[model samples]
Target: MHSLARRALHTCNVPRDLTQVTFCDSAGEHPDRVGLDGNAAEAVWRSVEALYRTGVHPGIQLSLRYRGEQVLHRSIGHARGNGPHDPASLPRIPMTTDTPICFFSASKAVTALLMHMLSEQGLVNLMDPVSYYCPEFARNGKRTITVHQILSHRGGIPAIPRETPIDVLWDRDEIWRLLCAAKPVEVDGAKVAYHAITGGFVLQRVLEKVTGDTIESYLDRYLRRPMGMKWFTYGIAP
Candidate 1:
């Protein structure tokens, strides 16, 4: 096997054959989706390589899958930049198969899935009042708001006030209190705008309270363990 192919398989827990990568479901049942996109994958990788030609080298990695199989894997750039050749004072990054970078956003869909399961098992009613479980939630005009409002981005409370201490982020109740105390800008469900950052925490608390389970515990017991995927994070990992 090519060294890059070998490296990608080892790091990504995928099979060696980039041409036809498929794996049996861990649930011991049917196959999920599988395969690779050749042309589009080439276009994406070439675009990244083009950026380096412009002297704007950035750490870049691309992974593309077709159906469910990974067909393209490319990592390029440096943790630090390459000197003057860098167009700045950074060291040039030589792309390798396994360098880490952080990207954010998309916990919303995962949180939504959690809600789906909750609704599925009848643990909570999405359309029911938030105050039904969190009495303080009713303090402001939020008394009638539903978990569905929060999940769908229909919750009036969008951006948290500026400079709210970062330390308070991981505390669900603290964030919940802020949300409850704040006034809604919209009548629940009139229009939905992206919550950006604050939506995740706000929805998280409602989910936690209604189900009587911490988000961590809920994710562990229901989603992660069930699907066998571990892609959750609230803060710095130990």
Candidate 2:
């Protein structure tokens, strides 16, 4: 395990979660396709073992969709713990198709999608001032900020002050208070900077007020359940 990981670390930057590790540096051949006529099972297990030798691995599923049909579906690596070793001290914990894994910040793209859909459907005007929808949000100097600015991450309070207590972030009232009092470090809508984490939460509240729906229900009814994408959330799932 140590030797395999040494090679992987030297070759690639596949960051591992010490408490929750997954596959490291999953790679493929240059041929673009792996034949599965016979010995397919052996090939799949070989790929799994190759990953285990490196370090802790996660289940990685690769599928090819063509003409509305899935031509190839491959599962590589185990879920959590080291499974079993081939000729070593450990074994490989093989992964199955039904095993669902946490898809982290990829979840935010879904939130962005919800905003896009609302814009396309004419339900939410992108230019509308957040203050227009949520009058209470006009406090401080934020009265003029637009939904476009917020979603595009130009809304004033881009940089939440560093001294904010990390524990209070989940406290809705405290979080809003910090954001409400924050001053914009950059001019709104000049150039663009990724507001990273703060923009999403602010947009969430504004979204809820305008649609008369929580971000989850608004996203799920119009985005997830309809679109058949279930691995989505704005915050922790209820």
Candidate 3:
């Protein structure tokens, strides 16, 4: 019965051949340019291959640099289809080195950096209460929450209210309204609860209030363009 079940499972959900899904930009790899021997580079790539075999990530991209030169730039797996539960008929989209992926929580680092930049410019004081910039944030007993507290995950507004719809994340105005209206879990900055999504919107409001500009425009002008980043915006353009 065990052997029969194994056969049935394999027949129903056949694993994809890794070679069939792997894609690489041959021109982008230049180990010799960085003085890295081919064997060493291949060894590193083999580790990435091992990770891909684990089936945790649907897609993976690697751009390793050595001595300021690109030694390996490669990608593996589908960007869209080929999930373990996906139907075989679903069309697969190859995850290329150029494919754009969501940075998610990684963007918090950029947001925090921008806030520090604002401080350096004398536009904001990290220790000051957020209400000092955007008075609307003072609603719901959050008047004392400082910008530094928010950046450090002590803003007291950890998760959004349980009743808030998931769709609110995409609606800037609605999300801001909800965050402003929601009450805090605590306000002394004595706890270390993660803000998750709330701190970002709060920080954004403070930023926009002080700069008189949208965060997206600010990021593009100050960081993305200056650094020649191809895709580092808040959202992908449709």
State the C-alpha lDDT per candidate: 0.62, 0.60, 0.84
State the weakest 10-residue window (summed lDDT) of model 3. 6-15
- Write down the TM-score of every candidate: 0.60, 0.64, 0.75
- Candidate 3 local lDDT, residue 154: 92
Location of the lowest summed lDDT over 10 successive residues in candidate 2: 23-32
**lDDT of prediction 1:** 0.62
Clashes of 1: 8
RMSD of model 3, in Å?
4.3
Scored against the true structure, residue 117 in model 1 reaches a CA lDDT of: 86
What candidate 1 gets wrong by more than 4 Å, as runs, is 1-57, 64-73, 82-89, 94-98, 120-125, 210-212, 217-232
Q: Write the per-residue lDDT of candidate 1 for residues 1-238, one digit (tens) a residue.
A: 3435434443221223322321212232211334334455567656766654443343555555455444555565455543223333444445454454444676678778887788888877888877787778777687877778888888777788897998777666688778778887875589887788767776676677777777878888875565444344343357
Clashes (N, CA, C under 3 Å) per candidate: 8, 12, 0
List model 2 lDDT by residue over 1-238, tens digit each: 3546645454221234321323222232112243433355446545654674454444565443334333344555555444323323455455544356566556556667777777787777888877787776777777777878877768766666788778876776677777777766644677576777677777777777668888878877875575344454454456
Angstrom error of the Cα, residue 69, model 3: value is 5.4
Instruction: Rank all candidate structures by their lDDT, best first, as comma-separated numbers.
Output: 3, 1, 2
Clashing pairs in 3: none
Candidate 1, RMSD to the unseen true structure = 9.5
Q: Model 1 reaches what TM-score against the true structure?
A: 0.60
